[model samples]
Target: MNSPVVSKNAEGAYSVKAPLRGIRKSCKYIFSNIYLYVDKNPVYQPLQLWSDEQVLQHQAFEKEQGFELTEFKNFEDIKEMSCDFKEYGICEVTDGSLPDMTYHVSTKEHTLTFDVKEK
Candidate 1:
């Protein structure tokens, strides 16, 4: 099994990819939202939600394979923290709300990195 890859692109978008395996095809599993943690503290004020359409699309893809990929674009809340190497980050994917079946997609101690710009 492959662990989730959490990265910040040059455009400052945060992307998380979690790989799943042995999921039943009949199961209509849906990922409610994603939570980003920096040093054990939540980054965003309000948790991000997956739209109904997005959830459906994700389900469709999961039925064919096993994995969920999500991206957060232009999110100011994570900008500074993502650029700081000293701060470790983690991405969690849950089926319902908190205290539910939460999957820690990223590494146990992953550090965020900024894209280097050549002068």
Candidate 2:
């Protein structure tokens, strides 16, 4: 059995080094968030993980689907409505206490969070 090796560095800092010899199993998670915009031009704010081109593409797709992107009064209003775009990453609405509505999604690429202060 190999034991942990301890050594002192030039800075007089002692450290114990653990051996990493076994096969390590790990998990990686990717998350994304959708923010419901409550302004005059209400929109479920696009995610940061999406590129500008992707956003434009999604907008085009939305138009093609005849999905009327309407403004919502609050989080509940958004929750009550249905989303037409799911191919572009918009998912079900989640419950939150923030000023605006918030939605979350998880994928293999990255994680996401929505901020109310962001206009």
lDDT digits (tens) for residues 1-119 of candidate 2: 24546566796544443332232356432222222232223335432223333345566877899996432332223322223343432333334323333222222233222223211
- Please tell me which predicted candidate would have the highest lDDT against the true structure: 1
Please report, in order, the local distance difference test score of every candidate based on alpha carbons: 0.38, 0.35
Pairs that collide in candidate 1 are: none
Candidate 1: count the clashes: 0
In candidate 2, where is summed lDDT lowest over 10 consecutive residues? 29-38
Off by over 4 Å in 1: 1-15, 18-23, 40-119
| Best candidate (score: TM-score) | 1
Output the TM-score of candidate 1.
0.24
